[model samples]
Target: MDTSFLDSLSDSDFDLDLHLIMGKKSSQKKFATMLDSDDTDSMSSSTSSMRLDNMTENGLSEVQVGKDDLLDQCLDALYEKRGSTREKALASIIESFNSSLQNEFVETKFATLLQQCLNSIKKGSAKEVALASHAIGLLAVTVGPGEKAQEILEESLSPISDALRIRPETSKILSLLQCLAVITFVGGEDPEQTEKSMHIMWQVARPKLGANVAAFKPSPAVIAMMVSSWSFLLTTVNGWALNPKSWQESILYFSTLLDKDDRALRIAAGEALALIFEIGNLDKFCGENKDSSEPTIDEGKDSRKLMYLHGLRTKILGQVRGLSAEAGGKGSAKKDLNSQRNTFRDILDFLEDGYTPETSMKIGGDPLNTSSWTQLIQLNFLKHFLGGGFVKHMQENQFLHDVFGFTPKKKLLSGTEQRMSGSEKRMYKSPNSALSKARTQLLNKQRTLAQGRNAGHFAVDE
Candidate 1:
């Protein structure tokens, strides 16, 4: 397996049509191209946001370059005729931005530089475009999630709107979508900016997502991006329910995801919905839940909110029923149609049980939903995993070196198939995570073996 992610993307332009990327079949292949930008960067700053860039800095910046000189270097490298040189330059600037984000001069120069990168996205080959898209995300985070960055990002988005709206191929679309997600998150620090970015994303991304995508079949990469983007919106927005239009659209889109047979898409959609209930302050409308972490309508509920929730619930439930209709005989299609039967049922059950005392008891008896807790646990684990300690250990261990190179990153499925039907089944850990844990376990085994051998040697000497 070629671990040279950028080299692979740079090698050729993958002009993949929707048919080529229609289902899970081509999804893995297409995503292989999209795999280059995960927690990699030359330097560090916004790992809390974009979590990428960590490439070798050798010869990238031979001498210590000043902030202005660094920006000049980035632009110069980006404009280089050679793809490798250009990518190296872009990676350098991204690293600088990450480590010294608060520097005013760097922020100013980098902001302009980032816009250039966005504009350049349309100019390059598949690999070039992906790298350019990546630079926009990395540089945008460098601008920080302040009020200033928001305006700059908004300005940059307009220039790229047509590309997003017209709908490009899978590789290009993946890059653009990731750019949207990383910039919006800004390492999850600025709530206001995140909200605005979410709206901007919805505006640009809505028509191209879920029920209304490239064609009758949605792009897996695009769908997966929506799952993440939408979840962030619900989880972070202060008044998420205030935007009636977006709220309605989110429902249709999320319901569309919840209906997916792909485990990841379903979980992303489900968790987004769950977050809405938990933090959307739905209790103001529906009341409170005594048992679960989510709010309930145990007290006097607001009729308007209840009516609104009921409306959304009704729409979702209708979708589930339509799915239950099943297309005649038993086959893949039929199985896929009703695959999310239990998931949708649980969502509805959670909705009903939130307020119904008796249903609450029954729901409590059911297997605990560990889905909601995943993000928090993963966040802490990431902090620990990315900590100095973890990296040092990885550096010391030989097998761990290559193993820690990547991290497990799961996304929603593309092209419609409903295999991951349950909430528990819907989400998956990163394969990189499994590998990391395996290496650690192996290291422990080695330690035990060494200890035993030393004891035996000592016994023999005695």
Candidate 2:
């Protein structure tokens, strides 16, 4: 509570301390008052007002302020400008509060900060909005996982919804919303929370997706960001897929990505589809048959069979065919090629261990009916293009062997001594073999010459 240290600290640090000690209510009021006072005539007046507000709300009395003032002075020395000072101060405060805040403090103060940040998006300068968004992100991570955080998040949805309506293009706000979704879904691992998270995302994303598609053609950046964000949220599909409404929306969103003109979007969409399939399959496999600890070939085959019988595979393959045709003609084919390869690799890798034709066709056990198989085939087409003869190779090397139960023998090198006669191996049928032969011949000629020289030396000595 050193007053001198506190006096010298940046606004952000001061705010952080106030937030940690006095709580959100006091800190917020102080921030509002600091911004409100007109003292525009002098920088000192503004700084003083901010300082006074901090002192009044923090209730540091005297001794603590003195120590804090000195620390604040040290902090002030680190920044020359007011804005930079504020940013660094805010970051420092967040860092400090992150370590000290209790669960209750986090639930209430962190939630308030998020709401305030979202509200700030409607009116603050872009920089302020970005800072607030960053702060909100930090809170999301620090809050940890629990019903408390979940309840706070539920309350937060309305403000985010309002912000989306008021300022849809605000990237900062969008980022904040995405962070919240990530925390609720990925961080918490609470199925109920994830369902709720997906509900919020669908509400916002559905309209955006429609608008993006409605544009004569959406900007690549817009499409890319949308798909990326959507994919990120879908990564938490474990909880979401449990809810029928969320599952339907998830399918619809992925379907839109498949139709996008941007290859990147399509790739992201495919990845998301694969993830959803994996999640659904894992859940079903784990729930119905608790005896098996790991997913079996039978389960995978069943999933793939279900996917195909339901016509999901055909839909995905159709998209892949279109993408491949477009990729072949474009000057940007290499990039397209790699993206397609990665997408296919992901799908194939997911299914390679699980797939079996027989298992796929079993009752209520069909793999082809699920989206997993559809995505797998689409990815397979891309693999065929990138690996050139991939399908045939799989058939010849692995699939055929698996079906026929054939094991090929390893071959030994023929004429090993003739292959390495000299320093430079002689040419033979194969390039390596030829080189080895030339080396052997060179060594033999050198040995003969050395033998003659030794014999002459021995005769001269005698």
Candidate 3:
């Protein structure tokens, strides 16, 4: 099958209508295109607040009824007999989610929403599966890290893994890969759980051969997405916690991908390699894992391990150097070539000078900084996966703020909102202030402890 069709696709291919919010569907383009910038025409909170003050009791009740009915209708639509109906319902759910963080909705209907999405993945068409996968990701994000988040992971992982076991369309594969990365990011609190997720992604890209299972080859697009999603999860893992044999083979495998015909695959592999190098536990990658029954390594083995590390680094550095200066070929995309060149150049600089590139971006006018490859990969992956919702989550989702160490500037009240009493004002901002600071600190501490364990300081010998 010609998989090149995937290369021509973009987020706009998934554009959905928003008329469902008004109890009907229209041909007009309503939802923001996926993987694109936030629309400037987004409804303003200040404007909505003012409108609320003017609404009569009946009008306000009608508005509430509209929202409640829309959600109920979408949820019910999931159970409809037609695939298109289920797809539209999933799309409407996606629009409502991207427009706002559905904290209260998830709190009340987490299990039902999750199970419905999972059912779609198991039985719906390719498009339906894609949308359902995306909705599941959003559900996990809204729930954040807690028992509920863990439950999402536990309930969804098997169904997602099962769906991926069969060959699917490029969009479906992309969605499932992204969904796996996201749920694990939010819910897989332990390194083992995270590693388990990574392993699942690996198997999808390169399934193990068995007597009944023929050797399966994934498309370049699938391979690229797998590498990216795999690297996204790698950002949270500590270097020392990784299996020596697995990552040793991974570094070598990625180096080979650098020579692939596909530019996207090359770029994805380059980024993954750069992240591995940035993590920096080369000795561990080279050394043989000593079992309890076996004696410790002797001097000869130690010298061999050191030699292997040096040779591996040299090979990877050569590949990076070559890619950094690669010339454009016949029929090559100038944009893709430039992207590959820029990525490799950054990797080259880091490998040679130990200078990881620093990135800064604005979230609601506040800066979010990432000074390492890991953070940068995590940020980029999440931004791409979140699509138009990225900005909304950055502004309002405390989970995201904590993950990126971002603090969106507090907005001054305007219109009718300014008329609130001092106590009301304090109460309004308290959730964004006090609880936020405490959760941020707690998350930071948990990450620190996780890193310490990854360092092998707290790990027991296997």
Candidate 4:
């Protein structure tokens, strides 16, 4: 799929109604014609020139040309022309950000562009925000990895942190942060870079995330952002678990998100905690579980030490229960409902649990089960979260039958009701005849029983 074409059109402009009326072949012809025109070239040049002027006007001297402008040109070339024009446009954009230019302007204009994209994400609708998020990700990749890029990232985070403080609607800010974190973590294994990233996270959570901070109601958008960001962070942390120095700040960051009211937040936190345990962060949770090479501690002396393990397990289990309830509910949120269900299913798999018949029964009992279970069943996790063994165990549990109503019936053989092939018809004739005879006899017996009961009742009345 050419994403460049999509970059030019808003969601409404990609109208299915218009496509239906035009027919597929005609629509394709028109689309091709549009792309083949010189109009696209003029538009691209004009947009690029305007954006360059804007940068100069804003005192952004470092960024002679911005990624947005380049992307716009590429997209225009992609839509308007083919072959050489497209290649030339893409090459120009790529060549413009050479090593020297990248280093010189990355910290200033590049970072500023990303910040602007993030700001656009916060202000725009879902589709617009998603586009901005993608642009930010692309910028991260283009900027590449080094001490210079790392410093630029550290500098970039300051605005996001400030935005979080001022806006309080952290969904967009968190999305941008997730994009940044993923780039840094995946870009290289520089310990200094990792430390710098970790420090920024610590600073964000440290002063404001304590017990004394009063609870505030977060919008659904904010909650979604937190869940996405934390999920990405946890995945990275799991990969970095061998480095003990990285664990402290990350653990603290996740622990704070775990304390949020949103079920999605808790679910992400639980999955992260489960991952931490799997990746040998048990020592981080329980000092008692530390390696033998480490100094021994008096377990009895510290009551607070047990709090971490207790909190981790409690959080995980609570999230499991919450997700199970959500998936089992009648009026669950429709937005990303499948994503939420998958996340829950992942939690179940990480815990080595299955969606047993017994578990299904428990979920079925919930008032919200209709809405929740329907959504849950659509997720791939529902199929495998509980292994086959657990499923079998559920089948044997008698209450499970009553709870889920009935086991789904298998499809009948097509030949059972239709005319069969000669060989099949002959081979099954004797058995079919016997089954028919038995069914007839059973119906007769039932009729006789009913007649006798009616006669007895009438005779007594008479």
lDDT of 2 at 34: 37
TM-score for each model: 0.47, 0.45, 0.76, 0.41
lDDT by residue for model 3 (257-352), tens? 988999999989988877766666754444434441345657676677666666777777788888889998999999998998998898888776
Candidate 1 worst ten-residue window by lDDT: 355-364
lDDT of every predicted structure (CA atoms): 0.46, 0.42, 0.71, 0.41
Name the top TM-score candidate. Answer: 3
lDDT of 3: 0.71
| Residue 423 in candidate 4, Cα distance off native in Å | 67
Better of 2 and 4 by TM-score: 2
Per-residue lDDT of 7 in model 2: 85
Measured on C-alpha atoms, candidate 2 has an lDDT of 0.42
Clashes of each: 26, 65, 0, 9
Per-residue accuracy of model 2 over 1-462 as CA lDDT, tens digit each: 669976888999978887677754454334333333344222220011223335334333322334334224323322323343443333333333333332344433554455554554445544444444444544543443344345446655565555544444445444545555544532434456655655555545455456443423334444444445544554433332364423433544565677766677677676665544444432221222223344466757556544432454345545545554544444656777676765655444443333211212111221122223322332333232213222332222322122122222310122354455553543112113233234334433442333333222111111
Name the weakest run of 10 consecutive residues (lDDT summed) in model 3. 27-36
Model 2 residue runs over 4 Å out of place are 1-119, 186-192, 208-241, 281-309, 318-340, 349-462
Best candidate according to lDDT: 3
Candidate 1: regions farther than 4 A off:
1-72, 81-84, 95-108, 185-200, 203-217, 281-462
Runs of candidate 4 exceeding 4 Å displacement: 1-134, 146-151, 168-172, 186-192, 195-220, 237-263, 285-315, 318-322, 325-327, 334-342, 353-462
